[model samples]
Target: MIKNKLIILSLIGLSFISCNLKNGKIENIRKGELNPTVELIKVEEKKFILDSNTAPQPQYTQLYQDSSYKRKFTFLNTYTNSIYIYDYETAEYIREISYDKEGPNGIQRPMGYLIKNLDSIYIFDQLTNSLILSNDDGKVKNKISLIGDKDPKNTEWSLSYPQYYPLTVAPLIETTQELLFTGMYAWAIPDSLLEKFHFTSRIDLSSSKVSFGHGYPATLYGSEFNWDDPIYTAVYSDLHPDGNKLIYSFPVSHDLYLANLDSSLYKTFYGGSNFAGTISSLEEKKSSPSHAEMGVHIAGTDLYGGIKYDKYRKVYYRFLRNAMSDVSKDSNWKEKPLSVIIMDKDFNYLGETNIGTLKNYNWENSFVSKEGLNIEYLHENDINEVYLSLHIFVPEEI
Candidate 1:
């Protein structure tokens, strides 16, 4: 069984030619760049009612679609130690998966979770530094310590997604033989050493052996910018709909990266935003800036956000936070002009759709559905509302 898995990894490096659609026909242009063309999309709005006492935010929600086209998502309600499941289209309240806090099945402060299905759920426990697998009934099936005998002085790691630093994260990637998740580390180390750190860890399900690879792009080394800030180093990733490749990007660069599941080999493609201005840099600085100072600098900088793949349209979408102008130094981190860059399957730039500002919608919490891209709408005035609103963008040709 392991031999078959190794074979799949070896084939990932094989190159293939791709074609693009032009004038309603497929044409091969693999030798050079195709003429750049931008496409537009229309927006539609809808709402889903949530009768539960707890109001779930988009940052923590995970949307999953079944074979029958039923869209259901789950989010952890920490207050109740339960995971709430809801129907995406119909706004129906589904059942909740409740967990214990003390017994053998007890969970120790779960920071993030993944639901491959009702029967296969994975939870990352912060207290134990472990990953736990559970079922719909919340019965613990298996558990593995992520920090087994690792020296913290040399390296620190975590799977928990900080609530404050919201990133569109996939808690774990599950295959027939392995499970994978992007790892985060502390920034206390020197810039030279930190730049070489690996950002992914893979665990063999059959053997429970953990290994790390998939280092950051070479462009990250010796850069003028200070990547110590989480905002710059944070990654937004999505798995290809075919489940063979993992596509990810950093907030500091416009490059989109593809990491093969079987090998350390990877590839990169240009995916810069049309509206993104120059990203701010901290050059020739003798000391690190305060957190507030860093936040203020990043506020006026053009940075990228989460990346999503729309299987329905056979394209990808990435969030672009446009640079703010004439901003006050005292101004806290707030909403700014935002847009979504569309890319074809081959990472070709399609077009960008401006979606107003972050105040109106939550791009961090979004999913690609049959209707279009559903982004959560923020209701500032009615904080006690019992429903979740969304803005759906439908792609259209110009």
Candidate 2:
């Protein structure tokens, strides 16, 4: 198993004609290179309801279908060792994908995953520490173990560049076929390589290569922008539907970065001038504890909802936490506002609008679909069975 995995990794690397880092190295972006915008554009929102009462509540990590959830909803039931496909409109089960625990194509501890190929999605199985590419129907088509069979995760060594870590991760879709993995606070990494690896890296499953993405500023609240603690890494990211341009939104400073393939990095602030200013100061950041003790403390009380490109309107929409409404206020850190920021492909600020308040804002449960923005709400009509509410943003013709 070890020899084959290594051979596979080597072959994948060789297949790539050339792998170049942006500029072939990671450099600190210049000052004034990224500026937040204060301009605001208005938008209209209509609500669509996703009733979860129709079936056994499905456990899904991400939503890939349209806002309507009518087309297809994919879910993974880790406890059951199965994945399900459902039709949202009729609440009908399309199909369930299941495999034996010790079979030829079994996945263990499916930790993180993202959408791929139009219908099929990628799963990160932690037990075997491999990236599994499933068919659109949820059959495990191919399995590529990222590390060695003898536990490549806890080791303290390096063989070459593009190193693979068994560290925890949250996978996000970048290109239709590629995945971007953001390390979940790896405080356990040895000192030699503690901060060496960039926070974000690309897993080119096709080429079997791992590469770096833009790292966050190192001084924002002690965790570096990459750290999930102190400031929650509520990074809303999306790629241009046409071009694979990377768009990033941080609720912490209201800064949006446009790092395209051909251009120098561009930055824009979404809300008003006070938006970016509301983030923690350098002093406050320095004084804050590096380790997140209580909860993942995002910089501003405001949190980012989600960001997506409006394929229909040809504009970008970013959901922000507006009015601080509480779900379980008695509980620590259970409030975030519900707001949206509008922008164009050029990063020009359009306007802002406020929806109601999110019950409990979990980035995992919010996604942007072709129809509208779908977010999970704990209280729907005061019923707390966990439902998804869609906020359809109609771009003002301005």
Candidate 3:
């Protein structure tokens, strides 16, 4: 279940003059006043049947592809606490990097695994409250704990959020020097911890400094920040592959915000549809920590599927999952269709498509990989069998 949540967060932004729908250029009427010409690109899809011969069903699947694995579809299973490898063409189960849980170097209840490279991974170990660096062979190299209080560099930039480690990162912006992280918490911030609520922070690993003042004002989008849920949902950010620009969005509104890691640039393209009126009160948004509602994309089902930056094809994507208009709640949305809103390199509104409904909302069911956008049809291709049906999306230049 925990892995399921992380999968939803990672999985998904662009630009815009008057949207045209004629001659492959779709006409779009945005909720905002910006009437700009926009290009519409069609998507092509194919599926690489994932080899399910090795396991019954995975609890969670994360993209773990590298050159060593032939650049094929590889996944890390949270259920098994291991990596599963498959052939790109054949969908055959080649190997699994299964790890132990009882050893001195082992971890219990790992929050998630970051595929830093083919070899090493930073496992957020719940038991130790540390990120255990381990090799593909399950060898523990090191474990780095959060240097919150003991960092001698700056005492003011301390991480004071309770139980901090959701830490959503921009996929394309990860570098040796820095990484962008989302600060989503439900705690009430004191005056001392105001700097900690930068919304998006640039953690420079080389200098050991947490760069502040690089985030949009939470009060503007989060409906008055520092109220109850300090770790609000509106602060979720994704990387723009064009220049690795920081991208953010409002959950219930049609507002899309673009900025930089240093907070130097700021731009917004408010492109929304007729159903964009889906909104909630600031008081209602301040739900309990456990029940905090997230980005539904003006729909009822999706609870903030974080923005995704596709590096393979220089474009941005926002997955509007299971959108159902007939109801106000998410119960009926599970049977509705999914839409991938397309945007250009400059964050311009491009086009969108209804990718159909889904049965398995698990992370294993879908991902944007080196082989284009891949979504598995669980009902058609069963994991209980040898193969799973895949739905792939590629760019069809129109």
Candidate 4:
């Protein structure tokens, strides 16, 4: 089984060619010979050395904020084995809580978040197929299991592709005390399974429970058609500043969907084209697909998204993009271009600006501050070389 997984990873790496720019020149942009000035700001990097042997691989990190704009806490997921909490200001590991007392072994990628006002954290464990509750101190308090009687006709019943199994949990958000979560399931499963087990979006905490709506049915071919399922990939949701609406990213279709607290009305923003990229077909290999292409192909790419509201400009900062393309051969990749984009609250077109474009440039993570400041991590080719870039956009004198 491990060997098979390794092969899959290798194939994914070889699937596409690098998309880096050539001769260090970005497409559609002019090359300047002037001495370019780039600012370097330093952020304190405190280490939280964990028991590497015992710690599950860290898969994701989320920063939480209080209503007053103070840093609350940062949550880390160890791929379903355990959830760790760290102090944002001190950078110290606070606690580690495992969903299953026995700990995570395989197929469990637990993802979660810290709800505001609540002294507890909510986690979604994909391996054990359960929802876990933990106190602020990282102690396990309760859990909700997702696994039930399986039907042979159910797409989830077939263990052929466990990755598609509705086991990977998305981050958890809070609406008061009620917690909300989104899960993905393959479409090939039986209709009965879809009705009973396939859940695209839901809100459940202690007493309150609500469902956004049923997901589209899965296809039987178990091939490309199955990719059409709305819940095939990672689904992300964040609470609006108003606290009444939730913004979700439907990765499969590469569309951003907004759902009200009532889950009564849902709409797509930016006409769906605002978040997608163009892909061109490259020459085919003797055995590879002819239509195969490379170089930052955005169509059907995975995306990371977030929103920040600004009262001064009466606009919202919506950040969206997919993983950076491996541009090893292209000069553009060497001098990575900043693809960060900002959009209005209503999805109106504002303008495009490069966050940072310099030699040995690589972006790791980004977040918008309540004061409308954008903070991003720029890393060198080396894993340890990282810098925090603060981008403050002050409007011109009126």
Q: Candidate 1 or 3, higher TM-score?
A: 1
Superposed on all Cα atoms, the candidates' RMSDs to the truth, in angstroms, are 8.1, 10.2, 9.1, 11.4
Evaluated against the true structure, the overall lDDT of model 4 is 0.41
Q: Please provide TM-scores, in order, for all candidate models, with all chains considered together.
A: 0.81, 0.64, 0.67, 0.56
Q: What is residue 99's positional error in candidate 1, in angstroms? A: 1.4
Which of 2 and 4 is ahead in lDDT? Answer: 2
Candidate 2: C-alpha RMSD after superposition: 10.2
Candidate 1, residues 166-211: lDDT per residue as tens digits?
2334446666677777754433224444334566667787777776
**lDDT, candidate 2, 1-398, per-residue tens:** 11333223223312221111121121222222334343333232222233343222234445455434346655556666665655655545566566456666667676556654434567777666567777545467777655433454654322211232221112356565557654323232222333343444566757757555553333221222223342344344567566666666544545555555433334333332223223332222443444333233332345554567767667776776542333232334434555666677654566655545555433345455565545444444545533443333355543
lDDT of 2 at 200: 48
* Highest-TM-score candidate: 1
Better TM-score candidate (3, 4): 3
TM-score between model 1 and native: 0.81
Clash counts per candidate, in order, are: 0, 11, 25, 10
How close to the true structure is residue 281 of candidate 2, measured as C-alpha lDDT? 24
> How displaced is residue 344 in candidate 3, in Å?
1.0
Q: Is candidate 3 or candidate 4 better by lDDT?
A: 3
Off by over 4 Å in 3: 1-29, 32-69, 126-129, 147-159, 162-173, 179-183, 186-195, 199-216, 219-236, 242-244, 264-266, 271-275, 282-304, 326-330, 358-367, 380-389
Tell me the tens digit of each residue's lDDT in model 4 across 1-398.
Answer: 11333223223322222122222111211112112122222233333444443332234445676556556434354543555556656556666655443543222455544455345666555545555566545466766544433332455543322222221113455566566554545333333333334244454665534444423212111122223233233444556667777665443332345656664334545312232343222222311222232233222243334444455555544434433455332323224344434445665545434455533222323333343433433334334322222333422221
Worst 10 residues of 1 by lDDT: 19-28
Instruction: Please give the ranking of all candidate structures by TM-score, highest first, separated by commas.
Output: 1, 3, 2, 4
Q: Which of 2 and 4 is ahead in TM-score? A: 2
**Every candidate's lDDT:** 0.65, 0.46, 0.49, 0.41
